[model samples]
Target: MTSRAPAFPLISATGEAMRRLGRWCCVCAALLAAGCATYGPERPGEKIYRDVVFAAPGGHKLRMDIYVPRQSKPAPVVLWFFGGGWSFGSKGYHVNVRDLTTAGIAVASVQYRMSHTAVYPAQLEDCRAAAQWLRDNGARYGIDSTRMGASGESSGGQLAAMLAAAEGKSRIRAVCALYAPTDMVELAQLYSKPGRLSLVDKFLGGPADQKLDVAVNASPLNYISRALPPFLIIHGEFDGVVPLEQSERLFLALTDVGVETQFIVVPGKRHWFRLDNTQFAEVSRFFQVNLKR
Candidate 1:
């Protein structure tokens, strides 16, 4: 009881310290959450226009989902396609739409006829037509058609590459392909292992040996030239579906033809990998460099 007079002060000090610690924890948690939000797939305040018919091929309505950014003026547009090996996939499945839009870019997630519904050039045609539609109707959506870019993953990547390389009235200022098959003929040959041959064959409508011309026609490698737009080709090193060499060949061809290009080989990744913040930033920067000019 001799030192009891100071007990209240000690208890007050201890309570203050606990309060400070709790406040510090809350601040740290907030910072961590903000950091994670940057990389997270949360699309807030994005204006989405879904199921917009871009084309009607063979009586089928090819649609797209347009995600517009909150910008003062019209923003650059990036047309995105889904990967399904030309057999499966849709516009609803996209990764970086919010990230791109947040960076002042409008994103168009497109849909093309699958292999079960059509064939090689048919899918390519749908992509080209979608690009054309964006170019033609971009003004309505506050999009800068002249600053348009193309991007895709897997089979969608193939279509995106073709959109950038193939001849068209509207110009695709930049191209980004992720684990896509650049060379259909080469992919068909590489994936010729038993039970794998049907992947490419089904898309091409026949084997490479039987449909060599069609395969070449569908390959983005065959369309590379000096006139092509700047390209960023990203492929997984351990991709079993589309060989890494497909992107390598495309990168080599683009460089040999004097088209500005960059090839990134993701180590230890397979056909599909989760896109990190760095990859999203690279894509945003690539478009900003090529399109914002």
Candidate 2:
């Protein structure tokens, strides 16, 4: 039998390492538990007014859900739009509604006619009407109309951008768009390569070439001017539905015209990347800075 140096020493070392690792794991678990506890429950005073009609264009009653925060002073409002390719969506779903309201910001999730029911300008008109309604009736709900902003994801993002870019009395003071299409003509060109029309065509009621004027009129990029409000555009680098180039183009246009804009490109994320708590906090901070005046 070949006598080996005492194996006890190595065994003891391994045992000690295992014990240390066990202690480290316990600490980690405790920290995770503590973090989870911080997120305990929704705030008590957050209130949601459901299905309040804001407009009735073409006899189609458009309604919105207003989330009011419990604040001593009136809170700034943000009109939120949900993404559904401009053909399908509802105001019932919203991201960060509780978070926004908890941060002393009121949120209004607006309902608009989808492409299936109406095309192009109808959706924009409905959103404009909603903004107008919020501005006109803001006092009743403790909303500061002058400090209003707009935010949305995907198709909703496009509408939000349009609402901000529009040169009018009801234009939003700040805009945040997540993975929104900026140029309908560019989007149409990209989709035409597959020998099929894109949602742009559906929303515009025809191909870009056939509806050049309408496409130009509907694109947020076309409306970029010095008078436009501050814009925060966020897009995923790996977005397949709406290419990152779309956001880049919009950012370039805004900067070219001396418009205040911030563009964020999230890495390793696709079209539908769900924003985490930290990202939501950043968004809340953006609104707090811009909408809170």
Candidate 3:
């Protein structure tokens, strides 16, 4: 998710912007030379040889960083989106996604259309196309078409939930959202801190700009249905940005429709939520269970 004018530099949408992801990948790859940040396979059970590509969304391309475990056979594919409140974030923002590849789950860290240049469904559509592209060619990527999951944090979480909830099993098998937002109306109203910076204006286009109905339709919460894939929501108890309640609504909504779902709230964590050792354990475990081939 990219922000609007005067917003933080989250992600770039063009080949130039995507170059940022490639640059980061090179940096991470080089860091392994000295074993400083051994992204190859330092620890026991890790992904290796992560590569970046740009998924085409017509004129604009969505950046994708694909990771497959070193020496691992055909496995599940996991599409991970970065979080920036639908305003900022890059596929490179989240580092641990590489872990999924090393853990026998092929990971694709994708960059979608952001709120900067466009708005609403544009972002959703770009992400959806990314998933479809992966599913269409899972075999070429050494992925097991039978098992595929999606994961993201914050706004990416909302997008992840939206993708999983909106699509039938034919597209995705499971979803993992980290402190994501579902109801935009409630989120725009609830997290609107009194005077802190807010990207809602740029994301929703403000009262004087576009319209609220636009945000509603693009929101993941509005499209919850039985076609949704299994879900795993992990939220922070004190996420001032996106509350835990949003996760509750999604978890409950999915379960009501017989969709396998799980919800976990981190105790005493805030917006810049860090994955503790335990959280990492849970993260790997969750993906393993849902992304099994």
Candidate 4:
């Protein structure tokens, strides 16, 4: 969900911008982090690592918190991303993976460069780096690494889907996206509020109308392919922020390409709604079935 833009220093989109954005990102992250100070008491027999640096792109240190289950054998991992309209979000935001870890799955809540700090591919690149880091370092933390998946909401949802759909060696085995904007161009056009459109603008470094190529490049829908991993897409029935059609189109595109996918619309719900126990169970089951291979 988009919010009022914080005061950011004027910096050119260059090496210098990356450094400055890194600083600003920490500030925004700290503010958001305070809200998620406690995610319940730690589960028994669970191994937790916080603020583990996964990558340092352009001198910006990206981090993730890994929660490893107490399984004897190495367990599958799900890399989670957080949503903040690509402007500001913390790695700890909206993370609830107890079900996953309890089911013998590890969860890595990852942090990426926000749109206000960096442009489109930067976020993707940072996320990809996190995946690769997990692949390279997961063994040290009891993660299988071979069996990987991703899940996120809104903007983070887009990252998770794109990370899986985009062609790369680091692509995961599955993805679960919630109320994400799959089509950047459509999201920009559907914006009814002034601030909403600006979210797309700042993310793409300009208006989507002017940067059609960038907008297309940023869209997860355009990246759909048959080789992509299975997907579980959940959208609210009346999501005004990203709209239900966004997930619908992505589901259609994936299915058309012969990719395994499922679309579930939460009835009578709006954007920012939490999953009930049943819905959460479905998501947990989706990953368990698809990722355990």
lDDT per residue for candidate 1 within 1-293, as digits (tens), equals 00000111111223443343344334324433443133224267567787799999989999988888866799998999876667655577544434688888898988889887888889989988998898899989888888899988877888888887775314888888988888777666654544434557888987778889999898888887887888888887666556676777778788887777887777677666657788778878888888884
Clashing pairs in 3: 2-87, 3-87, 46-102, 47-102
Reference-based lDDT, each prediction? 0.74, 0.74, 0.64, 0.77
| Number of backbone collisions per candidate | 0, 0, 4, 0
What TM-score goes with each of the models? 0.82, 0.81, 0.76, 0.85
State the lDDT of candidate 2 residue by residue for 246-289, as single tens digits.
78888878888777777777877766556778677777887888
Candidate 4 per-residue C-alpha lDDT over 1-293 given as tens digits, one digit per residue, 9 for 90 to 100: 11111122222334543343344345445547664564555688788888899989889898998999987899999999887778876777678554689888999999999776789889999888999899899999999999999988888899998888664324588888988889887666544233434566678877777778988988998887777888888887755456677787787787787777888888877665578898899888888987766
Q: How accurate is candidate 1 locally (lDDT)?
A: 0.74
Itemize residue pairs with steric clashes in candidate 1: none
Residue 28 CA error for candidate 4 (Å)? Answer: 11
Least accurate 10 contiguous residues by lDDT in model 4: 1-10
Stretches off by above 4 angstroms in model 4 are 1-36, 168-170, 192-197
Judging by lDDT, tell me the better candidate of 1 and 4: 4
- Which of candidates 2 and 4 is the stronger one according to TM-score? 4
Q: Which candidate has the highest lDDT of all?
A: 4
* Cand. 4 Cα-lDDT: 0.77
Clashing pairs in 2: none
The top-ranked prediction according to TM-score is 4
